[model samples]
Target chain A: MCFYIVINDILKGLKNQEHKYIAQAISIVENNSSLNKNLLLNLKTSSMESIKIGITGPPGAGKSSITNQLIKKYRFEDKSVCALLVDPSSPFTKGAVLGDRIRMRDFYNDSKVFIRSIASRGSKGGLAENIDYISDIVEFSGFDVIIYETVGVGQVELDVVDSVDTTIVVLVPESGDDIQVMKAGLIEIADIYVINKYDRKDSDKLFLTLTNMLQLADKDKWIPKIVKTVAINDIGIDSLKDELAIHRKHLIKSNKGLDKYNDRFIKKIKHRLISDFENSFWNKKRYEFLNSEIEKDINDRLDIDSIINKIKSI
Target chain B: MCFYIVINDILKGLKNQEHKYIAQAISIVENNSSLNKNLLLNLKTSSMESIKIGITGPPGAGKSSITNQLIKKYRFEDKSVCALLVDPSSPFTKGAVLGDRIRMRDFYNDSKVFIRSIASRGSKGGLAENIDYISDIVEFSGFDVIIYETVGVGQVELDVVDSVDTTIVVLVPESGDDIQVMKAGLIEIADIYVINKYDRKDSDKLFLTLTNMLQLADKDKWIPKIVKTVAINDIGIDSLKDELAIHRKHLIKSNKGLDKYNDRFIKKIKHRLISDFENSFWNKKRYEFLNSEIEKDINDRLDIDSIINKIKSI
Candidate 1:
């Protein structure tokens, strides 16, 4: 009874758009606390829809700067925004996290903008799995827009694409040769391509290369648009914004928007069911059984059959 | 009875070190065929232990060239080598696969050398899961050494490290600055650091950076060694090989070698069990139930508890 009462207060606070409650709700989800399921399930369904935007690119592609600019643009239109920046625990990429946080500090005092940095160290599913739940929390908080920013490493990009309606693939003049871009599968995933750091040398050359490549892409779907921007100087941001608007329109017209939402919905339910099943199935006795069997002799494959039999019996 | 006979023949051929049977056996595991388990379990344990070496680095770091050169050196000593090159399906990096294959064409005709490129496109566990099983197959075939070469993408490097006895992190002078290297978590994982393309200007700068970083690392553990090489010219590979030998000695003396093998053993058991459980638990009915529930209303969290209850009922 007491636990339910506490949850009710948190839900009440969330309904009031209190940042404190929002942060607390997100923390509960991040930690996977015992109360998380109750809190998540009891929260009121969002009547106000929120747009999810994903910003992804290779390291050093100015993704952070562009995200900052986008936040400002959205805020100017009086829309509240929540940004989730995924920081990989890798030491090589850790420095960039600090750099990104520093660049986006302008919104620190803005009550309407919420910024959170998620550590991708412990999560085996590469942070994307949790992003879905986190996005739900923020969306229910009445934020008009939610942005997911991640560095392109491993399966992170593909995972991000699966969860977001709009994906912006940020690149720079020196990102790579034309062939590298095509090979990265960046061309297919991007709803909009932002060639950031347009002030840099050879920016036009890359712009033209991307234009030519995109021309060969499938005409049946919404063709991705390329925009050049000097993120630091804030040039060409309006054009990028315009492209996003146009892409959003395409998403609705083509019913790809509904499709993406449906995909995410199905994926979430599947993941949740699997997780629930895993928890129930892998009991302490089973784990001990597994460990003892492995301790006997790792190289011996004789026990594998017995193990499979046990699994089958379930 | 016929399947048993076929398995017996393959096992006998494997004992004779026939490449055809080895290829067939590997294909069975790769495809996850039903006969894979029976064949894998029946194969004789390795009497001739094989050394496993992992060569990894940034995409343009001459990893393939170094792998090719290492193969040549091992072949000259009359030791058989099996190299598993993991080719990421990302288009940006796909071109390099062709380039690497062309560079390594010398070993195609060598009877003692077996080179197989594993496509990482479909594997959800990022190829590392299968690498363990495949390595066992090759080791059972009496190979002298097994080399795992992967580009540093996603968690592939970390996964490769988990499976290999020796890890060599290859980096070119142009890879990144010291901070970037540190952030990538490369400094901690490398048993040996190779500054490939050392003939390039500023190669010495990277070498010095790596040395300073190593000095700052834990003194109790084996301090990582840095080697400079112009892989294209086949310079400094002997030195790299010598470092590998020294590292192998360290691995054994420190008992870390046994620890790595044990860790792999435990992980293989765990992964296999989980996968088996997943297969049994996610039956057609459960999947159909999940899909139907999701299609009704994605936003409603009301059905989540019912789903959890169903999962728990198992």
Candidate 2:
């Protein structure tokens, strides 16, 4: 099959809201196949007014349960939703089990809730290189809400959250101490903070600490709200849903909605261009040259600056 | 002053073991000054054999306290030690408090122990772009032991740890659940795991879990040792130090010592080249061009791929 035909079929499938084609297209892009560039080039910006939300927190913070709750809430509204779990694969240990999917099995049989796990490929970037493209594909695939769930509170997950319109940082009472929270800088990035597993004895204290810290931090606008939830029991899910709605309305009314869309669009383009440059510039020949040079006497070779300049001139 | 003269003075002062010159050289590189390229090009790799240790874990894992103990241990041996704390600057708040330094006040007045904090600069990579060069500067400045302390167990910290000869992952009993440790992928990167604040009730349980996990993971030759410590009171510091020595000896006996050195050397070169490419490629003009293009209609202008190809071809 020619690349064009496959892409066209995928596009048709996407337009028709076919989940199979959506999955295939995502796979093609994630693998960085030859046709992936063409796929992105041919893709138009998603015209659908979809809400993109990023959920991030420390590992074992019930991020999966919170996401499951969000998925159920959206599905109950009769809205189609897609969730992308960005799993960070370890560079040394290749086996990274996406156990979060087991918790999300309820949505597996529901056609309205499409869930996909994307490995980070253990790249320097916490995200896969094709993440933006994949998100765009999902956005244009007729979903009303696209939720991105990242496992850890690393820079990679933070970058993913930054690219989304709304970001929710989930934390458990035992996740860390209040000082640890401040030191990790988690208090700054959250548009909304979720204190999951609120049944813990220390939950109220942590909540109060976070609220006080937020007050002291002096966030100019849109003070982040802390919501308590026992996600497994489906408690507090409605309040969380209402908070999301409130945030959405705030964004739209404050003219930040258009600004955020533009910011994400520009960021997507910059990331794509950088990725393309890296792919084209660092080919097999370049790697061989770099490896060989690295093995030689340092004084015998051209400095890194000169080599970069020469490459640019070429 | 001319760049050559300034660099020459700094080099002379560094050779004289002047602490002021070492700090100045680090600053010049950290800022990515125009003189940095020339400085790196002229500086040769360190000839003195030194131990590079990376200590990383989740925030508030008593990393600073552990580091302080290590520094004291090394200084007690009449060996000069330098510590680098890689702080992650928050993108939203832009306020990264160097609170770790306050804990190292005892070493501040001591000539044998030098402490420096490097900000992550909120770049995609966790380590700053010039971290390699800065480490090189510290290395040639005659420090016997160089310890890198990172605030979080993110990929940036992982990369930093990978470039070092020995990596110690510090954890507290309250850090997280066992699943969280596996999910964070911290199990694979530790040459030695330290359970700090060992007096906690679950510390013994966590230690057993880690040891079992290491066994199941099948580490080929060197088995990672789990040590317990109350770093604040200096309890178990000697045992931890002995484990570090044991790992160092194992690396030497297995002939991985040379391999690790070569790996770090190659990594340094690759990082420098990439940093150079990013600096030279993403100039003011390129930023303006990208920003302008991002504002245009998608179909009305060249796609990101074409733009990259055009830039490269130019």
Candidate 3:
């Protein structure tokens, strides 16, 4: 499985910036390579030329609708757009695939647009872990920008996927799990919260509640913006885009993203390492340790402390 | 953490269970005492007499309720019953809270009943990695039988919790995520699944689904009995008790519990080893190997095969 990285090396050997960027990324992802590692590291040190935007919302929250509108607007200007859709992993857990694709059926065959849907396979970091790598691939593949669409709510999903320069969380009237949003952590993580389906009468009440919650929170110069949109009719998308651009501009000016990306990258690596060990970790060293620990007898025999230490130190 | 274990002499002090039978098994779970470890080497080998029942289900499944019922029933018989609740934890992400205590309001006042909620606290095993030591704290306190209640549903929880003689999965109908029972591995591990809230219309449907799913699996000989109960009303309490006892009789006759306990003990220790190593091994070890591979620029850095090997080997 590891030897497939040869394809990636071959691509590097035949290096040409004009090559289809998507193909290059596909090779890297499919073929495990030394080059792939370098590519990831390079991305970490690179720039904000291709501004990434994240469009995410829970089930029935109009995230895809907003993303579709953004794609259309980008298309109208003759700009290349890439939309990456992340489907809920447990197909039965949540019905987030509520016609997200069929709704944008008209643009299915659009040559200027690159649409890709990734099914999260229960990886703990959710879709977030793959986002940066995939984003690099999409951006280098000739797309001016990429829009990452995420399922509204996921244990590990919400934060991990394509971390855009700007993150927009789509919400709706009568949003369930209000307490969840108000929770200190969730509220702090969200940069922008969009109240989609705003044309409805109940939107005002929801807006008021959310506002109250925000006002009550302790803010030290970080105030997540609330944008209202009726995505179905293509309303408020331009302002939303403008807001996203402004946020990106803010990030670059403050250099906040530099530290944030570094921290996230390190965290991602740690998460992946832990996941790898937990899932497998059992060829020989494990068995050797297991034998010694057992010979000690669990109740009093095994020096669990020492055994655990040996494993950790390994 | 390793030093803390030996400095306290926690292992030797807890293994003073020579005279009492239940004390031995209680020590196994409480301290998570490693069997292979030599603590039991000095003592005479003898079997313990205690009813150890494991209670499990998905996140919202009414396991606490069933456990509470069992405690009440055993109390009615004038038997000392200890309730051990396993709480999940991982400080790196969202640390799960201990919530069953509030739900178990009435059990607190009973002198004959001892209910202690066990939090993993980022411990290697979500179960007491120290095992017998912790269960010793509960058992040497002199409770005749112990009921282990676990939260949510997952392979780890089932495997760790099912060391008990009888495994019971308490479930509810009209669940938002009942389908998880199908997608997840619960259908196999559960020895008996109690459909709590039996008055709901979906109970019969859930039962049929479970039956159909199990029948299709290869474990044709291990037919897990399905019991329906309304824990709130204490309906079918006698029947549930009868089923549990019958299952116990069958297990003793078949000598399955002993094998299960021993097998589970080994696997439990290994799981702890993997988790502990995973927590720190990335920056701890992988960077050197991965960096060297990338530095040498090995085209086929041999990732997948190495990943499989690295994980297995670690």
Candidate 4:
């Protein structure tokens, strides 16, 4: 089949919520380093009211368990769910380390629920960009909710803010001190804070501290909701779902979703432009010039400004 | 003073090994997101034989203590040393947690040893690129040795491989399982592996395991050197320094240094090109276009391919 026919069938399958086409579409995006603009345009025109949620936390904070519980709550309401486990580890390693697979095993055979793991593959920014695109692909396939579960306490956590309508930062009683929390910049990114393993020692103290911290910040905007849970026991799962619903409602009422969509578009456009430049600009002659320039004695090497200007003229 | 005269003075001060000029030059690079080609060009003509060594590992690996000991050894020999503590954490946080400052207090009054800490500031690739430029400034300032101390076990560690001639991966007895060592891709990046806290349980075991793992890999290249040290007692530091000198000689004999230099040049050029593109391409008009495109109804939005093409045409 020709490329156009394949893409058309995929689009039709997406509208019908076919499993094969959804997987195929995700594969196309995952395999290509550059954004698949053709497929993206086709997917953009078919919209769904899918809610994108991001759940991120440091390792061993029980993010996967919380995600599994959330999935159960959504499925019970007859809502289709898609979970993207964004693994920031080396791409060569398997995703089993996160325990996301075992916690999410119940939905393995469910046609309405899909779970996929994504690796960074040495591209830090590209991973988040791909997540933005893949979320759309999943939403186009008729899923009602998309959850991005990323493990870590770094830039990856912050990047999720750009793509998702609601961001939930999971923490444990043992997460760290107030300084570490503030240093991670988690306060700014979280729409909801889940203090998982809430029955553990100092859980209440952490909850109160976070509450006070949030109160001290700008109160005009949406103050983040704090929910406590022992995710393994499925405790507070319903309340978590209720908070998500309320947050989704607030997003619509405040029109905050439009701002998020705008940010994603700007970032995607910039990423595309850079990718295109990298793809098109380098040639054999330019490389040879760089090599010879470096080969010059340290005292004789040309200025970088002159070299950059020359390359532009070339 | 005008820009040219001030820069010329700074260059002269750097040649005289003045600390003020070194600090000012680093600030210039850190404060500017783009490469300052003029300053870099001025730096190119000056030459000094400085050895750059990178020390990286996971947190709590006693890296700072080890670094302190190395500084002591270099100072004992009357060699001027510059240490760049590349903190991968949030820029808002101080670098006190790393303990590099506490351990190196002995050298704070010693003009022969210069220490500085760098933060990521939300730019992942840009941090490594700046490190490359900073190393040159430090080298051009008559420092005999430049050591890059980064705390992490991820992309930052790998990126250091491009800028430095030697890389030392530090590990504690309780670092993790064999799987984690492989998963972190540590086996591939280590030119030297230091099993610190050697008195702890399983230090010998980790040493043997790492040695066997290295043996199974490609033997045509220089086999990674492994060492054990009780950094607190200053045990085995001389041996570590010996290993560094041997590696330096091997790099010279094997011409591996040239390959590293070549890789650095390519990456710097690419980073420069992307930085230029981002600075040049974005404007009020392009941002307005992006805003309008995203503001459209989901089903009526312009295709990303067409939008990118349109922006390019404009």
Candidate 5:
């Protein structure tokens, strides 16, 4: 296919809310194909704004269930919702055991809800390079909300949280000891904390602990609210949705909404520039020369600092 | 103190296996102090070979218990063991919890064992940059085995595993569904797999599932062995040790032992060079100028690609 024709067809389908085009565009962006550059170039004219929510927490925290509940709630409100499930696991085995899809099977038939799973592909950046592009395309495709659901509370998930406007950190009663919660740095990134499986024993205690910890930490402009939910039973979904709406209001009222969006743009640009610099800085010839030099100098007793300095000088 | 004097003192203490000096040197390195360069320079001539093993898994997997058991087993053989527990968790709560220390309390008074907990400090690398330097210092200080324990199965942990001679992925029977293990990419990285909490009912099922998965995957040079352990009760520690030893023997027999160490050195050097380039590329003035430009251009409708291209041209 001609590059322009492919780009225009994808754009037209996206603008018309065609699910097939959205999926095709996401795949192209995820793989970072040549067509994606043209697609992104065309997407620059899109000014549509979408609410980006990041859902992250420790593993087995019922994130997928909560996301499913949120999707149903949003769809019932006559809003279009798109979900990008970011699995930081290996790309090789992702297809064989896609647990997230199984958890979110209810959305498979919903035309108003678009869902996609992204595997990390072993990038150091926890997120793929074109996540911003994908999100932009989805927003332009007329989704009211874009949800990024990541599986763990690692640095990669934290980076994903940074890219979103409002981050919802999901936790369960048996998540871990208090120390584990604090260690994961979950307290820092949470704009709203959801204590899922609220009927479980010790849920109340965990909730209190989190509330107390939030109090002890230096207060941010918007105090994080903890919502209790039994997502499997569809309990407290309304309150959770209301809390998300209130948080959005707070961001706008405090005039931080634009700042948050602008920050994401800046981050995207910086990442692109750095990636370009890295690609240009290390040509194939230079890389092979450096590799050979490193192998030859392995037994030379040269310290790493000196070796780096020598490479830089060269 | 003068830089040379401080470096000499630390180096002398490390050479003598003075626990205080080892701890102090690790602190200096973890903090990335100026004197660390001198210390690394002085230690490059020391050529002691210490077996480096990386142990990684999800939270609540009893990693420390298994590590404690390994310490006991190694100590029983009259070999000194040094463990660096890399907690990619927050540095803020690290001092407060020190949970791993509590879990491995048996090693506190054992002169043959030294344990240090490293908090990530939000560095881009899930590990502190000085982990290699600390490992080298400890190896030169006469430790027979060095163990790297990281909390989560994130990319940072994967990078750490790549630098080690052998990797053991620890898991529990209730570590979520079969999908969680596959999602963790744990299957691909394991030189040896330890199913801790073997007393659990579903452990046999998980074991069989893992065995079957391994059978389906492409064969590697060494078939990964699964060891069942009730780490708290000290079960299966000997077999795990034997498997690690056998893996080490395989590496030697395949003539990849030195190659592994050399690869680690090359990685360290490359990381240092990249970090240096980043630091030099983004000076304070340039950073401020770029930030201002981004903030200005964010609302100007200029796409990220053009901005990056312009920056590159400049």
Candidate 6:
């Protein structure tokens, strides 16, 4: 398939909830490590405009409000901005007051602002395998900035944020406590921390605590600025932008962002290959066989080692 | 360099906190989807008596204490059981309390009880590569049952335990209340449920809850027996043994264990081969050239696609 058309199919597949095709596309994005003859040519020919900004935070830290604000700001800059919010599909039925797009509906009607909601669809990472690929497609669709809005704070979210140039961590006044709860994962990953709901009375106390914590905890000298933003009123959005600029400056000056991007590129390649290797080895047929094997051994009573030797002999 | 010698070095290295070998062993385990001929032969030749079992539960559910009870049970069993408690490894500090062994030190004179506490050295999965290799070594040393213990639960742990003939899940009185938390990971994985600390006031309440909850869930049709064990007094040890025998009888009679064993065997072989293929690719002088290309591009802030192309060319 032509690269553009292939990306379109992926988008259509995601939109239609075609799980298998979505999985396949994600595999491709992850394995973009391979320098296929066709892919390289596409890269050269494709005028895919992309601004991939990754956002993540622990639950109840107001990441959505920050995303809503960021998209609005980018819309002010230009009309073409696509925001893709990846939601946790597993926990879907539990409760959701505002699904991604609905939560940020103010700019939804503005043709300049394109918003899409994606269910996580089994990938532990907030954004799945082909998300970056999808982001590229939207960017090429003429969006100025491709904003990746991830739902929760976990290893996978941290990983995605690190892969991008701009990694914004959303926090709240009470997030200081969560920061302590989640320091090991968060402290190392964030390029900037936005204290959402900054109008809260304890916001100042939270800011000082964050700074002190950063100083004591970090040795590589990554003290991400704690930007305060009352996202509901959009009070600190401009300052957040300034902090982003400053952070982006430090990233370029230190060449740190470039280093991380390279690392991610390498990782993306390896990860895709590894997962594919697993998928092929344990595809439907293998899964069926495994299920039967499980039935005979643990459930139905079979000799475990002998059954294994049977497969190995095959 | 030999398999037997390498296994010895691994244990000794871990004992002394010299972990280069562990990292290498981990690299092998991490590649679960593939394995090659030479590596298999090496592991096979160096094989030791490792009794593998599945230990699973919900988060913060006292798996560590249950693990201690299991080891303590093994010491009572024959004094020839080497207990390996895997996972629930916190990286912050090298925790000194080998919690499982501390509860089971009755074998001071019995040199046969070799206990080692293992953590997920890198990823979330407790045992993947090294544990298998470590099991091989311990088996060669002739421990009767190489009791493989896992704390807390997940898919990977379930997969590892599925490789064994018997699986045990240790739970407390509160397990009934939190059964929902474990249904996905441990619900179907365990062959037996050891409800430790039956002396606790609410043990009956917990037991009733477990029965009611188990009835509510579809357990892939296996009604795994819930055996109550007051481990502090070594209660129900005989019944646990009798139940194991009964399960083993069914296993030998049904050929079910053999089939599941076959599934695991096929997987392990694939894991070995995949690792070999990638290692050979990256270990060559070619990898350095690829690194150089990536370094130049990243450092010079060139495009990612270009560096990928350079690496492919090398």
Q: Which candidate is the best by DockQ?
A: 2
* Evaluation by lDDT, superior candidate among 5 and 6: 5
Docking level of model 4: acceptable
Query: Which sequence of candidate numbers ranks them by TM-score, best first?
Result: 5, 2, 1, 4, 6, 3
Give interface RMSD for all predictions: 4.3, 3.8, 8.9, 4.6, 3.6, 8.4
Model 3 DockQ reads 0.10
Tell me candidate 1's TM-score on chain B. Answer: 0.91
Better of 1 and 3 by TM-score: 1
Q: For residues B254-282, could you state the per-residue lDDT of candidate 4 as single tens digits?
A: 87776676566656667777777877887
lDDT score, residue A265, model 5?
71
- Estimate the overall C-alpha local distance difference test score of candidate 2: 0.73
Cα deviation in Å at residue A309, candidate 2? 6.3
Report the C-alpha lDDT of model 2 over A1-314, residue by residue, as the tens digit: 68678788888898777889989988887666745645554466542268888998876678888888899889988999999877656642233344666667888788888888776652334363566677778877878898998765556666676557789988888754655676665766788999999998889888988877777656578899999999999988899989988998888888677677566666665566555556676767667776676676546657656655554454
Q: What is candidate 3's CA lDDT for residue A15? A: 34
CA shift at B89, candidate 4, in angstroms? 6.9
lDDT of 1 by residue, A182-300 (tens): 43446667889999988889888888988887777678877788898998889989999898888877777877777787777656665665565566767777776666655665466
Q: Residue by residue across B146-223, what tens digits does model 5's lDDT show?
A: 898876655567667766789999888876367766766677788899999999888988898788777866665677
Cα lDDT tens digits, model 2, B223-293, are: 78999999999999999999999988888788687677566665665555555566667777777776676
Q: Tens-digit lDDT track for model 1 on B1-314?
A: 98878777778887777778888877777677745654584343432157789887655567778998899899999999988877555544455456656667897777788877665544443455576667677777888888998764455566677778888998888655654565445666788999998988889888888887777767898898989899889999999999988988887788788678767765665566566666667777777666676566546544556765675464
Give per-residue CA lDDT, model 6, range A12-78, as digits (tens): 6644435444445445544554333124212211211245577776445567778788877877777
What are the RMSDs of all candidates, in order?
A: 3.8, 3.5, 9.0, 4.4, 3.3, 9.2
Could you give candidate 5's per-residue lDDT for residues A1-314 as a string of tens digits? 68778888988999888899999888776666744654463465222267778998766677778888899888888889999887665644664236677777788888888888876542334253566667678877978988998766555675677667889998888764676666566777889999999999999888888888877666666789999999989998789999999988888788687777666676676666556566566667656656766566446655666655556665
Residue B97, model 1: lDDT of 57
Question: B-chain TM-score, every candidate?
Answer: 0.91, 0.89, 0.68, 0.92, 0.89, 0.70
lDDT of each: 0.72, 0.73, 0.58, 0.73, 0.73, 0.55
In TM-score terms, candidate 5 sits at 0.89
Error of 2 at A180 (Å): 1.7
Tens digit per residue, CA lDDT, model 3, B168-247: 87777743233335433345567787889889888888888777755765653557888889987888777888888888
Give the CA lDDT, 0 to 100, for residue B114 in model 3.
64
List candidate 6 segments past 4 Å from native. A1-218, A223-254, A271-314, B1-51, B87-93, B96-110, B119-127, B147-159, B166-221, B224-250, B283-285, B292-313
